[model samples]
Target: MPPFAYRRSAALLALAALLTACGGGSDDDDDVGPATPPGVRPVAGAEGRWDGRTSTGYDVLLTILDTGETWGLYHTGPIIHGAFHGTSGSSDGQLRGSAAMVDYDKGGQVHSSLYGGSYVPQRQLQAGFVFDVFNGSYVAAYERAVTTAALAGSYTGYAGGWPHPLTLTITPDGGLGLTPASTDCLVRGSIGPRPGGRAVYDMRASFTGPNCPLPHGASVAGIAVLDGPRLTITSVAPSLVDFFAFQGHR
Candidate 1:
């Protein structure tokens, strides 16, 4: 997709306020984490790392925590990247869920959607979702084992698109630091092995400085994936209205 077209979708997301009622837990559920919203449940056999592609041709990487919190990243073009977070529950081999998504390329416009599908534990997942005027399906295969040794390094790349250089450093102990060229924005975060030891890492970060996309002192939650020499991180603000993503190579 062209940059303008992506921005147009972001605008639509910002203007639409659609809600669907489904049988699930509420945001106020005592067990729900601060990062998880309503309509989420901890379903069996749905926690792991999934790699796939959407019907719209976007590459997708998704992580579902044991606690039912979900984080996902999708990209079709350099300027068409975004992230989503929610949870999925299963019943009789069917999966149902919802997520709040943010378009980082368009200044963090937010939207929500509902998804349903089927899955085979440790094998594959297929799901379809609708949000605003957009509808698409995705299929993913499960991946296993992600080690910190593979993630500790220095990476250089762009944030959102080229011409804006960004540097990321991950310490052996999972500490993270990010610096964007010629900018005061310095991001600090942490990454650690998830419960299942799958091809996914738990990630939490905070943005600081006047030049940052998110307000200073804002904390975001998400996940990270390492693909050979490349690293991808996708995170969203607590309000779910803003997101931070990075793609780089060691």
Candidate 2:
């Protein structure tokens, strides 16, 4: 999806998750025994690294800790990076927080930005907007990940086009090979370690087959979350515009 589209989608997903979790019944309904008590349960699916791009092509990297704290880095162009810090709360299955950063100009002028958004746990999605006297928004999907050895197996899924089977072979040495049955794309990449037990991987493939829609080469970079027999991959680069999702079960 385009940056704007994903941002909107993330916002909607976050809102829906919040409404579903925090929604209350009408007065006509009986009181459900004073409602369930909210606790410091450390929200699920938000404590990880999320990488994405802003609508303006800025690279965004977000890291959420298990302690409800969040830190992020935003890259504007090649070598300009800014940092922000904030805290988050999980209530009724929803995660939300506000973060800020102070920037100094060449003459040491102070500038800051404030941002807040909702976390959609089901898709491990983080969607929110920034307030810097300028309106900006971002949407990023996350993956709960483990080690590479734990992910060794053959996965059959579809990417790019619906119903096109894509087979992946993940090796223990952080290397992988991909074969898409519907296209002649030769994909190869490595999976590197990220904080919090998650793996960050990138793939560069060239379309050598017939009738390929993509350019000669495209980059696929994202994180993977593995659970039992299932694996979920989130695209920070290609996004849904390149491929809807990469889902596979062992």
Candidate 3:
């Protein structure tokens, strides 16, 4: 099984700074401090606890530490658990890691073992696959999750004299479907499973439709901020002087 085929939008404004190392010390100089890798950072936009579901519908819980390492818990025909030590870079969008899984019996004995898979970041969401090393079969689909019922109902906003109505509907299984209105704009993409009770949500704002001024299929990566009865959405696009923003009320 693999992650659901989630469509990706446009480029996002890079948000983190990469670390650098210098080598000017003498051969025997002990004053040189430990240097962080050139690409690794302390944290990134992808750090957090996430609740995910595989294409097979198995539930998964993943915690990505600030150090960019990951621990995961899942079940695929058996109780499976694993720890994935992964790394993220400032300029790279993919989070790669080696994974190992232990299948335990009812009595807590190790029944089988497996390994493989890596994390991939797409637009505003992060997802990846894990494999059964023996057969090469796998399970996937990892999205950030938040408290249930945190984002529901409809929110309305405006931009450039145009009224935009955003509606978010959560599925019975915790999937999200978002429909936002814009003047002659067709908004495509689902929004749900906000990041672990946080106010921010990853979004794919693809603007398409007749009479729309933006480029056809012009995509944008965005984040939605939720505040009591109020929702704010913003995106960055180089073609525009300022980022696109819309403030809505629930």
Candidate 4:
């Protein structure tokens, strides 16, 4: 080969190698990362407080934590009728989950159901429930910070099937004391702001005294949300057979 021709050929080969290294070769490239799964993309503004009404006409309060754990309640008037807890996920304005619902009106009857819906971040959510569908708007109250002192107060309300009034007191340190107006039942627990600083609290409590509808020493775990003078609490037994839901006003 001639000297100039040989140099041109070498430059051409180097250019071809550079192009191949830059992903200009065949279509089957094993170095590429896997594509994201369909319908599993992260959704912004899906975690917050949602206030809405169910298809059954019951008012609902739903809270979705940053960790995708969900807790909610449905009520008629000021009395909480049922509560649910489950894991949720959202993608492209779509929300889906499966949860266990406990009916306080029916002596804590528990049912499992799957749910799905659509959402507009910080705007609204429309989801289907076991027996009804929910349409709710975002509650700005959820953006407020939660603290033990903010929740320290006396609350009056009703527990499941309890004939008398119930009193729930929270101390400045987040200690909880619950007592029926004229009954021997007593519940003791602790509450505190959730880790992510959202407007919700983590609660763990146990029933005590013989008159308590739940077995003595039965423990429950759940979350709580405060709305102005009203406080709503929903906790579930480890056995899933019994639940405690209280809607009270300070």
Candidate 5:
């Protein structure tokens, strides 16, 4: 059981279906600290207000690179959990099997492991690989991928204009769980188990940004592969939000 598999959830912006770990089963600060690794730790970035008095803050965290080097990533903190793909290496190093990766957190909550990224020695970093994983469609889908050795989960993405903020979830029974604003019903989907301990998933996506509209519903899709995480959304404007590439480990 490898970690970092949950990255697919975020890139798809699979906000609803997967990654309950972000705000579920545990607290945000539960596993953040130096206990996970020697030098990898958290650094508070900025504290700001969302609307008026709603204080929202972000923290910058860093994990070890494949080289055991402390500063392994080019991106800063407030990283979405399980969103790291690869750091540094060359294509040859990866194909030759020398590409390396490790997982660490402020806390040691993450245990299982996997190779979270591909290598690209040219830039002394890994390749920004992404997958298109789809379980169902619309608001109930699953985007699965790897970010680190210690992190892995699923996610459903929603893009475009949404009527309201949406919530997505995956039931223990492998059923899609959706809480959509347009409908009172909880849209559901299902997937079967696969070999090697990897479960098949359906991606659920919604486009419910505060600024989006109603008629122009968000467009969502799933791309699940052994690659990195990415979003191909044609929203108010066509945009690709590759969270893994933008906000990798520190």
Candidate 6:
């Protein structure tokens, strides 16, 4: 259950069924309405291809300094080779948190991309995601995901009693971008490689933070593999899927 802190907590609660840039870490509810903020705590997911057998979900790249707060990078295909790397952030005293990169090949499939630094996507979902990367401060807890495959390029894992620094990047149109180490914070997305491998579209990301406050009905369902491969989009209101497997070579 330590797949790099559940791969940064289900990559932020099923990121819009696979990323739309923190698009409702748990579904921002139809333009923010219910107003459930105060001590929110939702983002808690971990499906690290449990090593049943099939998992070649490799190809990763993520980098974030101690400011970007959150970052991005993604990949899709039978990876699981060594399950990439692993880590998750949300200090008990550790610092900032999140993790990924696992494609051992058997049934390798898991792609994630993220980046938040616009100031905790509206107070970090009012604490639903909780925070404490030591002192950088935190208070949001919203995340998502479900599906993948690959063995492309890029990979990194360095969690040394941290404060920040999670990097990843995978392109080829599967565009997964996240850079922290100096900038401030940046997260990008675009991974739609379907057919036989999987991931038709996970996180086509389109974001806008800074003074974030536009939620209603609040919707952010989880589960996804994008579209074609295995566990297809499941929830997320009208669309937002799920389904994750590979350890057994599925």
For candidate 5, lDDT tens digit of each residue in 72-152?
111113232222222222233331111122222322122221222322221121212122121111110111111222123
Q: Candidate 1 on 86-196: residue-level lDDT in tens?
A: 887765545667788766555566777666666665455655545222222221212344567668888876554324767889988898887443347778889986654
Q: Model 6, range 1-250, lDDT digits (tens) per residue?
A: 2222234555466332322223122222111122333453432322111101112232222212222223222224322222222233432211233333322232333343332212232222211111111112221211222123341234343221122334445454455444432233343445543222211233342223331111222232222232111222211222211121111111
> Best-fitting candidate, measured by TM-score?
4
> Relative to the unseen true structure, what is the C-alpha lDDT of residue 19 in candidate 1, on a scale of 0 to 100?
21
Full-model lDDT, candidate 5: 0.24
* Candidate numbers, best lDDT first, in rank order: 4, 1, 2, 3, 6, 5
TM-score, candidate 1, is 0.70
Candidate 2: 10-residue stretch with minimal lDDT: 23-32
Local distance difference test, candidate 2: 0.44
**Tens digits of per-residue lDDT for model 3 on 1-250?**
3221111221011111101111010121111123333443333544544444554555554545454544444433222322222243222443334333222222121212212232222223234442221111111112222333555666554432233344544333434334544556665544543433332455545567774423556665445544456544444343332233445566
Question: Candidate 1: where are CA atoms >4 Å away?
Answer: 1-44, 77-80, 131-145, 160-163, 180-183
What number of backbone clashes does candidate 4 have, counting pairs of residues 3 or more apart or in separate chains?
0
Q: Give the top-scoring candidate (lDDT).
A: 4
Candidate 5 residue-pair clash tally? 52
Q: Positional deviation of 80 in candidate 2, in angstroms?
A: 35
- Runs in model 3 with CA error above 4 Å? 1-145, 160-183, 193-197, 238-242
Question: What is the TM-score (0 to 1) of candidate 2?
Answer: 0.43
In model 5, how large is the Cα lDDT of residue 193?
Answer: 29
Query: What ranking of all candidate models by TM-score puts the best one first?
Result: 4, 1, 2, 3, 5, 6
Q: List the RMSD of every prediction in angstroms.
A: 9.4, 14.2, 20.5, 21.3, 18.4, 19.8
- For each candidate in turn, the TM-score is 0.70, 0.43, 0.34, 0.78, 0.25, 0.19
> What does the lDDT come to for candidate 1?
0.61
